[model samples]
Target: MPVRTSPADAPLRIAVVADSDTRWKWGALTARRIAGRPPELAGFLLRGRATPTPRQLAEVGVAADALREVTMAEFLRAAEREPYDVVVLALVGGAAQAALHGLARLWPGHARRPVLVTGYVGVVYEKLADGLLLRHGADVVLANSRHDAERFRAVYEGVGADAAAVTEAALPFLGGAPHTPEPGRDTVVFAAQPSVPESRADRMYLLRRLIGHARRHPERDVLLKLRSKPGEHTTHIEEQPYQKLARSLDPPPNFRLVYGNMGEVLDRTDLLVTVSSTAALESLHRSVPTAVLTDLGVREALGNHHFIGSGCLASWDQLDAGHRPSPDPRWLAAQGVAPGEAYEGAFDAVRARLAELLARPALAPVSPYYTPVTAPGYLPGILARHHLAPDGTPLPGAAPETEATGVRRLVRDAVRDAARGAYRHGVQRVAPVIRRMGEL
Candidate 1:
């Protein structure tokens, strides 16, 4: 069916809440293209606790009216005030997904509610359970590849989501015109993410290995790309900063920690190494030689499993010997990242889907009903981590708790808190150099 709006009708409104740089660029570019100079296009820079800096906004080409900085709560209240036709979310983080659930519950059965469209902003391996939960909250789930779309559908159906909710959409590559390698500047950048449990120990190992490689091949400049600055908050709180970690080790003359303008860095980079970073996909799209570090095993949480059997990933042994890996065409195609293909189809699909949704605003299904044992007034503390009890006073107990159950709960909390404290202590104590190295 055709979109209800004509050229003369009011321009469609879109609200984008981005959690990261890549997702922000994706939303901005897609919204800009779809909106096409007709009128104002509003969006949100939802960076959790961190606000978007002017430098960050300039880098992403986000204009003043194009995107406003807002918290999840503020964004939801705004959605209530002047309803948008669609809301594009970079629902990659836990808090973001949880916020979506909160919004869903808040606006139950609202016929004019905006449709939520989300996708994987990076590698997906063990996150299927979380992805399913996200699907439960969203109206449409965008898949990064045809393979991913199928995978999402199976998971959604398994979780009893509507069959029409999932759709195929390629991950957008906003870097215009892939660059060829410049002669005499052989830069090898290791895109690091230390927040993943599997990568914590292995990340340091890989860095030492990279140092060894850099020492052996002094002609090549090695750069360690970090995610965030020390003491800054990201979606996932990084335990150890690689900068602090690297400070303890003797430095190689050719190696340095590099940050900022990831796309520009990739343009000048000849070889890129990482552990399941979406940057690998971007590198592949740019025809840069890229490798997924397999030092960490293919556990679901580590997300290295996605690269198994794909030639794009290199083993620790392989990278240790200075072997550069190329992405297998078949594997790349399966991941829906083959070159020269129209990556913009995903944006087109989003636009079309939004148009359809706007035409029939009430098409999205209401969530399945559930009966809570506790009353709504007393449920905020249990249901929400961020939402507090009334005036900071604890809510009345839903039911009398047994001694055994209370003790068990206390024990669980104690253990969890202790483990978290130990991890944080290790990270803080070991803060010599080379701290968290991935998101930025």
Candidate 2:
């Protein structure tokens, strides 16, 4: 396949559309890693329920050449108007599918279109088939590990969809100095997830155990690495925030809540613990002694089940007894955590694939597996939720609005915050009460 090489005067122009803080970090970092050269990178934050605030963006700390927020329709319009060589859809499956169809419609038959890329932010433990099918049309669907790439291809091939799109690549944000044991102060960082243990009781139990561990090891620093503040949203809705729950408990002086880059925290970390956060992969990549808690069982719902054979699973009791589990070398390699040269070349294949796609004169239209024809009963609703028509056009009153300013912008911000607060309340408080009432 012929590879397109941009002229010396012109750098590759790449666009990344992402929702939520985690996806933004993944998308922005991935763009830079795959650019090969210092490409002109543009970032568009999908303005919706999970859009990260400025504070969240700062905490994640990944930056682009230019960054702005856009609705789905606005993004499609921008893609049509701009000359981006590659467009990464760093969004949820449904949003990605909608964008794929929309782009296909806008650049119909023999028209030049950007090389589309889509993928998960981390471990895929649920909706495997559903998510893969939704992302089927992209030029590349990145898999953070060889294990994920294999599974992604199998799902596509099993359903008779093209599996060539599945590309094996390591997580872009997985680089840091190798772990070195800190003298005197052994820091134990428990990476908290937004919704792994969805129930309040479960979250509280984990918090109590963390407190117990801190008490047991008074000389050590026990940090709860929280994802977001109470009012902020993330990739998943955080119902029972550890911050709120921690306020109710009397934790030791050594025990404290922390918010910052996970990599920075891992710099001093002797042990990294989590139910299941992508932070585990980052920790493993840096050779930090890591543990996936088995106190809550290796259940699929909790996502720790993905690490069942990783050899990193241990109970809090085991950790308390100074048992630092070492991950299986084979498991680490398979999960794209290979050391030295092997890890460095993890994205080679995908980069080559992107170059080849870019070289094509007139690429084929985006053809996702789930269309109005293939999934008549399902696809429309998904599109409609994003205010998109089945054909990928924005619905009435859904066209991109001009950027609001001054009083109007303030009102919009206020309204959005209130809505998010209400949603969090429903998830944390009302839903549990309803469930209890149903049980009664």
Q: lDDT values of the candidates?
A: 0.63, 0.88
Best by lDDT: 2
Model 1 RMSD vs true structure: 9.5
For model 2, the superposed segments whose C-alpha errors exceed 4 Å read 1-9, 400-402, 405-407, 429-440
- TM-score per candidate: 0.77, 0.95
Show model 1 residue runs off by greater than 4 Å: 1-11, 19-39, 45-71, 92-110, 197-200, 320-322, 361-383, 386-440
Per-residue lDDT over 319-435 for candidate 1, one digit per residue giving the tens place of the 0 to 100 score:
767688867888877776666656645457656766676667465433521113313443344334434232222124421233235878789657755664565555555542345
In candidate 1, how many Å is residue 266 off? 0.9
Worst 10 residues of 1 by lDDT: 391-400
List, residue by residue over 245-360, the lDDT tens digit for candidate 2: 89889999999899999889999999999999989989999899999999989999999999988999999999989999999989999999855567788889888998888778
Candidate 2: worst 10 consecutive residues by lDDT? Answer: 1-10
